[model samples]
Target: LVVRLPLYIHLIHSHIHTFSFSYILGPMLSYFNFALVSASINIFFFIAFLFQPESPYYYLMRNDVDNASKALSWLLKADEDETDKELELMRKSVEEDRQKKAGWKDLVATPTDRKALLIRFLIGFVRQFCGIIPISCYSTQTLKAAGDSFIISPDNCTIIMGIMMVI
Candidate 1:
């Protein structure tokens, strides 16, 4: 989880720079580069995922025995036929999960789960309302519009924001 923070910081830092640079491009095509860059990255990731295999559990639930066996074999580093026991266990687990109705309904059904959901919902709610997203998205334009801080480039303002975010 600690390592996850750095990754998020890096991604948000990229967003800061991308939009900061957009301000330099002025209002006409302000977000063009950022959109292009973001889209290209997303397309690359999408294509990468296209090559990846579907989850074994998904195939098993669909009753695609052949594909489920193959996926299980790949996951367990064993031959497809060797996964019979694993598949049987997965079948049992899936049946149990279905019997328990362990889906979105369960997320808020019980007292403990409801509390967990409330805590998570509040955390996400606070995160967005705490100014991080807007700051990263428009801190450059905000600095530019402020007029008094005209000496520091919008790009530099983004760097300062990024540093503050990391710290």
Candidate 2:
């Protein structure tokens, strides 16, 4: 839930911005209406954070089992006993995984795993540095050069590129 809610809100904001820009900004922009749209999205997210529930997983990781149990009970509408049992299971699973002692060296020690890791790392680095942003920027410029009006401004274009990097 900790990772999911922000992504959900971001998806909502992106959809809103895309629709607003395509329909509204494409026709208007007399006085920085795009800025207003951005501001409204920010305000909506701020309000959402005010009402967002705390994550049980985060509390559990912090070793605050009481708060974690309360959070789980609130989220699941379950009894304390059930919540405690679930939390204990989750904790055991995590500990078991940790006891496996997986690390970079484990992968490097195996030829096939080492090759896979190297390939994955190379692909990730190439995608981050070369693939996505340049393609998007080129496409945007091509569209602009062809006199195809776009609601996606250069700033938003850069922001989208940044988001791809972070993701």
Candidate 3:
């Protein structure tokens, strides 16, 4: 998990940059160019996913043993015998999960559990009323309105805000 910290950060950074650059381009480029650029990213990901194997669990859940075995073999890079053993283990795990039952009463089963649940609810309630989403959505327009008082352009300020989020 520690080794993947950079990967997580890179994912966040790329997403922020994508949104910031697209927003900046919307005003500067032709409407078609802006749309093409935005759509191209999604198209690339769609094509890439087309070649990837489906989740073995998806096939297993549908009782499709043959496809599940094939997917598991490809994903695990294992031979037939090893794949069969792993598949059996997976089947047992799924069966056990299906046998278990959960209910709303489980949320407050213990004092510690109840405390944690209450804290989570409070945090979510506070977050919803915090106005962060609204603020972020209107930030560019707000910056543009106050741009006359600043040295930098509103577009540059937007990029700065995106970088700050990445940090």
Best by TM-score: 3
lDDT of model 3 at position 75: 80
Question: Which residue window of length 10 is worst by lDDT in model 3?
Answer: 1-10
- Evaluate residue 167 in candidate 3 and report its C-alpha lDDT on the 0 to 100 scale: 64
* Model 3 bad stretches (over 4 Å): 1-53, 163-167
State candidate 2's TM-score: 0.52
Ranked candidates (TM-score, high to low) = 3, 1, 2
- Candidate 1 C-alpha lDDT tens digits along 1-167: 22246679887687566545544443334377657866787899899979878777788778787897787777678764567888888878777877775567867888998899999899899988998887777777777788875676766766666656545
Cα lDDT of model 3 by residue, 1-167, tens digit: 22246568877677676667755675466769878988998899899979988777777777888998998898878789989998897778667767878789988999999999999999889868988657665676888877488788776776666567556
lDDT of 2 by residue, 1-167 (tens): 44568789877676555544543443335347767876888899899979766777677666787887777777778787887888787677656766798876887898898899999999889879876655654544555565536577654554555455445
Q: Residue 104 in candidate 1 has what lDDT?
A: 78
Q: After superposition, how far is residue 143 of candidate 2 from its true place, in Å?
A: 3.3
What does the lDDT read for residue 164 in candidate 1?
64
Q: How does model 1 score by TM-score?
A: 0.61
